[model samples]
Target: MEGKKKIVIGLLGESGSGKDTVAEYLREKHGAKLMRFADPLKEILHIFFDKISREDQQWLALQLRERFGRDIFPKALKRRIENESGIIVVNGIRFWEDYDFIEGFDPGYVIYVTADQKVRWERSSKRGEKSDDGADFKRFQELEQSETEVHIPEIGEKAGFIIRNEKDLNFLLEETDRIMNEIANK
Candidate 1:
């Protein structure tokens, strides 16, 4: 689990594209190591805030970025993964700069998970319980625009694997499994 060839995977997609679900599945099936970039904010939250809300976490994350700049997470992650090998799945890679940073570590694969706009919006509404108030499609679009640019089409085109998640979960899982097996053999 620790001292195996480090295969870094980047999951890129817009909100509600089931990135987390796919990442979890890959990790469980392949025994891949996992890292979430936003976790540094959560790690030290108790030192700064009494009750760490998501907004608070986001604010602290912004603060860290302000202090450390765009490469903070990736640089930190590089060190954490220095002695680690095998499949290392990076969850929540937000920026293009972050992508380049991870790419510097090794030749890795990017997987873009996608779904139809309606399905994606519905999933976002259901999953964004702490953040969004059930809103119109235009409003949801604007909100997502305010967040990270998903670069969905570009990322998808560049991805080694593309999983269309608008179908049933079982189908998605099967497609994901096939991709994992292929990547593992590589």
Candidate 2:
């Protein structure tokens, strides 16, 4: 019998959609490696800036995409993990270009996690990340609009599986486990 092939799972979602939670679950339960396309930008910010604000990170990410191309970060990540073995859970896939680029690689699955806006807003507020610290409902909407400019909704549509993360942690974990099993069996 042939051995199970390595798989790459690309996570797509808006802010507070539980992509990180899913990735962490995959890592802890299934021994998958967690990687994010934002790592490069974060590394650059760490080197040059004393204190990198959320706006700075967003600006740098956008500038990098605009200057280098929409697929720049995804391509870099692909190259970085090319020789790896086993499951790789990639978080923070926002654009169709990112989807297409990663999909071109072998044995990849794109999973879109979705939650209602009100639920997401509450979660984001409770998390209180520096970027989301002072965002009111109007500000949240504005930020979400800017985020949508990257074509996240279209990317979500392109996903192989859409996981609605509206319920509790147990439900999310069960759903993630089911998806992982399906991917492994494919």
Candidate 3:
């Protein structure tokens, strides 16, 4: 641990699982460093492929992985976080590739947040992301399930802690704080 920079907390969960909110809370409350997988993809797509549709952006993401292999983004993000200190939260982790890539660094903790399906849809609808297009339930489910082809449990089982994000924000925050303390004490 002499050469290790700081503790990293990787949060993996399904869409609308409030991962972003939890990450923000951690940054605000714990003064943790943060990196999100979507930021790089969004920046690259906007700069190089202007006027691309959301669907096309998604397709391009898949193509980028196919071309560079899945770990490119995760490795790049990890490099960006290497100099940081204190707790760091990695958001937007998707595939098992992403998980395994981060696991290589041996993060101090991995937390998987989950919510009820109906709550997830409602939250996603209001989250202001592409998934929040106010579409029908079936359409939304198809779109969401397609984006998250793998099951959350597959990743959650790998997490050191799990938080259900259905209650009030303060309640969720309290639970997150408790879990953070629990992990830090280990």
lDDT per residue for candidate 3 within 70-170, as digits (tens), equals 77678778667777876778887777777776666655577888887778778777756562346666766776565544556678888778998999888
Structure candidate 1, residue pairs in collision: 4-86, 5-86, 6-86
The sequence of per-residue lDDT tens digits that candidate 2 reaches over residues 138-160 is 77777777742347877898899
Taken over the whole model, the C-alpha lDDT of each candidate is 0.73, 0.80, 0.74
Question: Candidate 1 or 2, higher TM-score?
Answer: 2
- Measured by TM-score, the strongest candidate is 2
Candidate 3, position 140, lDDT: 62
What pairs collide in candidate 2?
Answer: none
For model 1, how does the per-residue alpha-carbon lDDT over 103-173 read when each residue is reduced to its tens digit?
Answer: 66665878788888789888877765444436668876765553344355565676778888988889888
In candidate 2, which residue ranges exceed 4 Å CA deviation?
1-4, 48-53, 147-150
Candidate 1 weakest ten by summed lDDT: 143-152
Clashes of each: 3, 0, 0
Report the poorest 10 consecutive residues by lDDT, candidate 3.
Answer: 49-58
In terms of lDDT, the poorest run of 10 residues in model 2 is 1-10
* Candidate 3: residue 55 lDDT (0-100): 54
